[model samples]
Every structure is written in C-alpha cells, then in structure tokens.
Target: MERTESNGPVTVPALPSLEPIRLVDRHGRRTAEPVVPSPDHDTLMALLRGMVIGRRFDRQASALARQGGLAVYPSSYGQEACQVAGALALAEQDWLFPTYRDSVALLTRGVDPIEVLTLLRGDWHSGYDPRPHRCAPQCTPLASNASHAVGLTYAARRKGEETAALVLMGDGATSEGDAHEAYNFAAVWNAPVVFLVQNNGWAISVPVEKQTRAPTLAHKAVGYGMPGYHVDGNDAAAVYAVVSRALAEARSGGGPVLIEARTYRLDPHTNSDAPQRYRRDAEVAYWRDRDPVSRLEALLRAEGAAGDADLARFADEAERVAADVRKRLAEADDPDPEDLFAHVYASIPPSLAHQRADLRDELREG
Candidate 1:
C-alpha cells in the first residue's frame, strides 16, 4: 500500500522490508526457510531458562499482590517472547523505554527482576538507574513514552551520538494521540527510534477490532514515512531476527520502524481484572493452545536441539534462578520515606518546603 505524507508519496511494497522468518507454527509445523540458526544449544537453553524464570517471577508477583504484598501487579505471562526478543535484540548503546508490562523483557535484558518488583511494589521511583541500564522506569501512561524516546533519539543524533532507541507499547496504545504525534515527529526529524507494538488481540477489555479500523498496526507506519512489519510474536527467534535487523537499520541512519507483533495476552490485564467477565473461555482456550513457550519447545524437541537429560538440567537451572530470585527479593530493602523527600526537589522551592515541613510536623505529632 502507498501513502502520501507531507514530503511525497511513500510506497509499501508487497513484501515486508525484513522478511518474515518462522521456525514453528501454532500447530507445531516446521517452516522451509534456511533456519536462520537457532541460538546455539547453550544460548537457546539460556533463553528457554530465562523464559521459565520470567514466568515464575510473574507468578510470584501475582501471588504477592494477592497476599497484600504489593499494591498492583501487571502480568507479562503470554507476551514473554515479544518482550524478551526485543530487549535482547538491542545493542548495549541503544536505549529502552518500556511500559509497565515489560518487566519480563527488562529482566531478560539483565535488569534485575527483584529491582523491577521493588518498583511494582511501590517501593521506588524507578527499578534501576537509567544511566547504567539505558532503560527508563515503566511509563504508566499509554503511548506517552514514545515522545520521550523520540526526544532522546533527537538529542542523541543532534550530539552526533550513534545510538538508537526502542520503545514498546500495546495495540490499544496506538490509538492515543501521543503515539501518532511521536511517530510523525520521529519521521520528520529522522530520529533513530523503533516502535515495537505488542498487539495482544485486546487493549484491556476492548478488542483489537475496536482499537482501530486499520487492517494491521504495522501499516500505520506508512503515514509516518517508515517501514512496518507484522510478525508472529510467539516465534521468539523470528521476533529477534526482525527486531535485530530493524535496530541495525535504524542505527545505520535509517529512520524509525514500527513493528506490530501478532500475539495474545494469555492472562488478565492485571491482578484486579477478571478475564471471564468480558472475554470468552473458548477464545482464551484457543490462544492457550498457541502458547509461545510450548510452540518453541515443540520446535526444539522436533529438531533434536536437546535431549531429555538436557531438558531436565535446563529445568533445574531455571528453578534455581527462580529460587535465588525469591531469596534476593526477600532480602530486598524497603524504600526509605526520606528518599522520597530528598528526591522531590534537588533544591526545594520555599512553598514546597513549607508543605514538606508541615507534613513532617504532622507525622511527628501523630
């Protein structure tokens, strides 16, 4: 499809700029492509291990929230591949701006899962420092972080820095004005940022059909003079390949690329949501059958990537990681109340200072 913007007409060819690479299907069928080589046995094993660890972390967070250990919890259960692949695909220099649902991706990318939990537990302003990790705290406002990412990219490019930015959001987030505005600015200014949208079929309770009339979210990239590609989010390898190529292209001076990952959110939107209230059991069942981890496992087994003993060892390793994570979190220090006051203002204004003093006085009196 061709789209005409302010500059001129931009045409989208019949095929995607990056070819669709798939190793396995929902039904467990193998593809004919020259298998872009799975991560070496050990690497693939680590990825699988990471996936399990991520899921276990999600489970623990949910359980903690239910037990009143946290104020809220957003689960990244089914969207693991999209998060993990995109995060892992980035270069060390690239920046990541993620929404609340990207903890799994952040963890897979080396951001400690315990730190992420600390933020979710309402104990910190951010999970970790942005300078060291090149990752920002999770943005709660849908699609708003895209603009922040675009601004960072613009600044980096202005300073002649060769770094790219990757921002993630949901399909529903695409409907927000900031999302389109960010894209337009990124395109016009030639910012090096990639928008990765995980279209999990629903934006909360609203179905994708209601989010927009567009056939696919990726097609929206045409309006901004960038290439867009749609890929099976369940296929981690394929997601990794496409995103890695897009990141490379962006870093090489190409402008932004929008990637729409076709996947399903296998869990409720959050701990407070009840999927049964609005979604059907059969529909959820259908997606469960297409679960990404199981599909990838099938491919690995069919290809004889690992034997039963190897699988046992990998499983044990994942368990060990999960246990260690639990222990670390158990020892995680609670956030200090004074930390909030200290960071509220580098140099507090008189009016704010008075309010803080009043609050402290009230606390002391009570």
Candidate 2:
C-alpha cells in the first residue's frame, strides 16, 4: 500500500495491501513492523475481556437457538475480535449500526443480553431504545442499514453535532445496491461514517470469492474517494487499532472509511444452517487453531500484560454473564401479540387497525 504524506491534502490509497494488516500473528507473536502501536495495557486488557465474554455469549445464544429459546440466531462465533473491537472503538456519543450477526458487538456496547436477543427471540422490532444507546436495531435485511447510518451521520453533521456512525455488515452486504449508495452518499456528503465488513470467508453458503472480483473488499472504498483498510480480523489488537483510527478520522471530518476484516465463521450461519453441507471439516479445523480469544490470551501472557489470575478473572466474568443470560432469557415473558400493531406508527392506519381488531377477535374466540 502507498503511504500518504502527513502534511498536505489528504489522499485515499489507490489500493489496500494484498495481505491483511496484522499486529499479532497466529502464534500470538508480534509482527515485525507492528504498524500501529499496541493499545495501552488497560485497553489491551479490556479487549481481551470483551473477546472472552463475547465468545461465551455467542455460545450461549447458539445453544438457546438450538433449544428453542430463540426463534433464530446468527452466531458471531470466531469473529469475537471484530465484534468486540468495533464496539470498543466507538465513543459513547457515536452510533453503531449492526446487522443480525452482531449480537456480540451489541453486548460489548453494554446492551442487555436479553434485549440484544429479543429480535432473534421473535418478539419486538427492537428491544432497546436506539436514542439512548446510540445503536440501531439489529437489521435483518442485508446492507439496508448502511443508508440509515449515512443519513444519521449526515444529519448529525448538519446539526453541528460531532457524532460519527459505524455500520457493520458481512461480506455479502458489499454486493447490495444499498451498500453502494450509502458509500457514495457518505463520501459525497463527507459524512462521519465508517463501514466495517467482516469478511468471514463465507456469506451464508456463498464464499467471498463469489462476492466480488476486487482484490480485497477494502479496495472498493477507493472508488468512493475514501480510505480502505484490510486487517486480520482474528487479531483483536489489530482490529481495534485500525477501527479506532478510522473512527477518529471520520469524527474529524476526514470523511468515511471502509474496512475489510479477514476472519472466519466457525459455526453455521445460523442454527438452521448446515455448514457441513458446503464446507469441509479440515477448513474449520484450520481456523479453529487461529481462534481470536486464544490468540489474544497468548499475546497477553507473552507480553506479561496478563497473568493466570487475570485470565481466571476474565473466565469467571464470562461464566457469570452466561448464567445471567440463561436466567433472564428463561424468565422473559412471551411477546404480546398486540405489539405487532404497536410501534410501526404513532397512529395506526385504518387497514392495520381493522386487522388488529380481527386478530383480537380471533384470540378471544380461541
């Protein structure tokens, strides 16, 4: 990748590096040129804790899906580094626009686990107040939230607010027309927004190879007059550093950025998916060895940044979170059928009102 001058006009790189940027290698060894300085000790510790808890939360959600606690769940298994870093990189005032697969990210942002799973539980449109948390609902339609993020950031800029937005999507999302429009609008308007594509090798059943012909998904940003970043998504430190830098630049009016995080999805796309039908066992085994949580833990121990006690504490915290998730989800009340007509509008339309009445009548008859 070509480097731009520190002084003078800002320039977008013509292309992202052919290889993904990596701070920590698979063996948890530091890279030769560790481009971005490692985050301070405390930040590093937080990243580790987030990833650890995120993995546990992911496993619990997947189990819930299998046991009927949720209607559906898109587990972020093996993508904890990307999920945690994305949430941690943002400031409290900034917004996070997440897709269905980003529950781990939402959890890291301090959203309640029960609320985070409410949509998957087939209950509410959104369980939490977006305005209060600065997080939109977990979008199910691929890439649709991209436009919403751009609109919010642009509007915030117009209001003289310093808020920025981070939009998370999968590799499959990059192909959608909405994603392209969002990219173009954000660049043209100089909106403070960032697009993060977790290139986890597969888009449900389709691999990244079929998604685009571009060298890397990050290169797509060059066409929109914005910077693109390619990072090893399995490396928590690298993901955090890159996303943190992108958010800082966007908040400073440097415009938008697109980041492609190379990672893998160890579990099926959702509980219903049969990954074995498409991918082989050997491929999954390869990525299992590069597990993000273990990789980060190794780095911590190697650097003497964390010891056995610290690791145990993180594990204990994760167990507590899992237990809490189990209890709250089990205790969650079934959604009110009437709620279907509740949040869509301030005043219900006549047609929907009639339908709501019919549903109520049917329920009463039953």
Candidate 3:
C-alpha cells in the first residue's frame, strides 16, 4: 500500500506470503532460495550460542520447578530460536515486552536468571527493575502487554526518541481482545513497535486450527493496515533476519509490524499442565526432531562455521549458567511477608496502612 505524504508517496510493505519464510530446512540444510537474507557467519555463531544457552536455561528452570525451587515454570524448550533471535534482533535502546513464557528471551537480553525466575518463585511482583533494563515485567495476563508496548513506543516517538518496542506473545494471545486493540492502536497511531506472535500450534490444548479461521495469523495484519511477516520459528537465522527488518522499519516511521512465528511448544504449557492428556507422543516426537538448538548447531557444523572446540565452549558456558542458576536459586533467602506493601505505591493508602498496622499487631501478639 502507498500513502501520500508531504514529499511524494511512501510505499508500505506488501502483504506477507502465506508460506513461513525459511532460510534453512528442518534437516539444517540451507533452503534452495531463502525468502530473506541469511545472517553472516558471525551472527549465525552468536545465534547458535544464544540458543544453546537459552535451551539450557529453560531446562534448568523446569527442573527447579519440579524440585520445588520455583512455584511453576513455563518452559520454552522447543522455542529457543524465537526467544534468542527475538532478543538479539533488537538494539540496546529498544524496549522488550515479554510474556511469562519468555523468560529465556529476557535472559538472552541480559536479565539475571535469578531475577527472571523470581516472579515464578512467588517472591516479588517483578523480579527486575523494568526501567534499567528497558524490559517490562514478564506479563502473565494474556495479550495485556501488547497495549503497553504500543503506548510506550507511541510516547517515545512523541519525545523524538528513535526507540522501538518488541512485544512477544503466544498463539493464544492473538485470540484476546487486548491483542486486537493493540494492533489497531499501533497501526492507527503508527507506533514504532513490532508484535511477534510465537504461534506454537496450541493455546493450552486448543490447536491453532481451532483458534481462528484466518488463513494465517499474518493475514490479520492487513486488517490493521500494517505489514505482517510469517517466518519459520525454528530457523534461528530466519527469525533474527525477519525481526531485524521489522524493527528497522518500525524505527524508520514505517509503523507497527506483526510477525507470526510458526513454531511449536514442545513442553506442556506450564509445569502444572499435563501434555500426556492433551497431545500425542508422536506429535511431540516430530517437533523434537526439529529442535531449534540442534538445527542451528547442524547448520553451523555443515558450513564449517563452528568447530568442535567452539561448540564445546558454548556447551561449557551453558553448563556454567545452569550451575550458577541452581546454586543461586538454592541459596535465595525466603521472602519477607512485609515486603508486599513496600513497592505497592509511593505513599501507602489509608486502607493499606490500617491493614499493615493490623498485620504488625497480629505478628507482635504471635
């Protein structure tokens, strides 16, 4: 679509193709013709390292949940490509709005593993300070962060900052009302934001087939008057390239772009979810063969971009991260009950003050 501005007409990005853009096949072979430019060797290696670490982190977090270190965990085991690539695609100045399942993405963005898991541990409202890291709290409510992303980017644009916001959601979030509202608001206001829907084929047992009737989630972008991209979520290189391009366009006043990453959630939605009751073993096995970490590792080895020593280094780093996470989390202090009222507001309200006093008196009596 073309729109006339003060200086001639500007061409909006064309509608995305129905096929998810793929740079590499499931077997880790480069596609005959990639839909977008592939990342260079350095970027590929970086992506590989990030995915390896992310997968390790995800596994460790899950183990912690089972061992009582965390209250629960939403594993991103099969979707490391989306998590690592989404974080790497952004500039440091850009903001990231992530969902509960995106802890790996937050870790990729340099958030501390302890802080990332703090919310799941039920110790704090948010694990880390949102402003210092330019990442919002990992939102648990479906699609609510979408509107927050739009509002932040729109405000940044007004202040003449070349900042872009990337909001990550799952396939289920697309079905939420806030997601649609955010989509419409971003397009209408031309907010410098990108929405990445990690469509992992299920909304907690309800498959994508039952989610919407749209040919593809990317098609929904046309209704919002914004460009949409459909990309193979397992292909780390493709995800990074597409997201990088979308973020660039957003920062350059091209408005918001919605990306539907075709990936799969290999694990249950959370620790409490029972995949055995919802999905078949055969289906899980199929996605396991397309594991993002191994896929990128294969491509690197095939291209001679990564040697055994290099791969070993990445693996060692991953192990170290896992060990550190385990050690620190185990050593964490128990949360103080009084801390709940600490960050609630700048000044305590009358009702809360009364409650605090009552709690204090009750504790004293005990």
Mind sharing the TM-score for model 1? Answer: 0.88
lDDT of each: 0.80, 0.91, 0.93
Clashing pairs in 2: none
Model 1 steric clash pairs: none
What 10-residue stretch in candidate 2 is worst by lDDT? Answer: 1-10
Top candidate, metric lDDT: 3
State, as a TM-score between 0 and 1, how close model 2 is to the true structure: 0.94
Clash numbers, per candidate = 0, 0, 0
What is the descending lDDT order?
3, 2, 1
Model 1, backbone clash pairs (residues 3+ apart or across chains), number:
0
Error of 1 at 93 (Å): 1.5
The alpha-carbon deviation from the true structure for residue 128 of candidate 3, after best TM-score superposition, in angstroms, is 0.5
lDDT of 2 by residue, 1-366 (tens): 444566545555667898989998999888999868777778889999999999998999899899999999998899999999999999999999999999999999989888899889888778787777789998989999999999999999999999999999999999999999999999989899999999998988998899889999999999988889899999999999999999999999899999999999999999999999989999999999999988888988998999999989999999999999999988888888998888799999999999999999999999
Per-residue C-alpha lDDT of model 3 across residues 132-249, encoded as one tens digit per residue: 7799999999999999999999999999999999999999999999999999999989999999999999999899989899888998998888888999999999999999999999
Q: Tell how far residue 289 is off in model 3, in angstroms.
A: 1.2
RMSD values for the candidates in order, in angstroms, are 3.1, 3.0, 2.3
Query: Which runs of model 3 end up more than 4 angstroms from their true locations?
Result: 1-13, 345-366
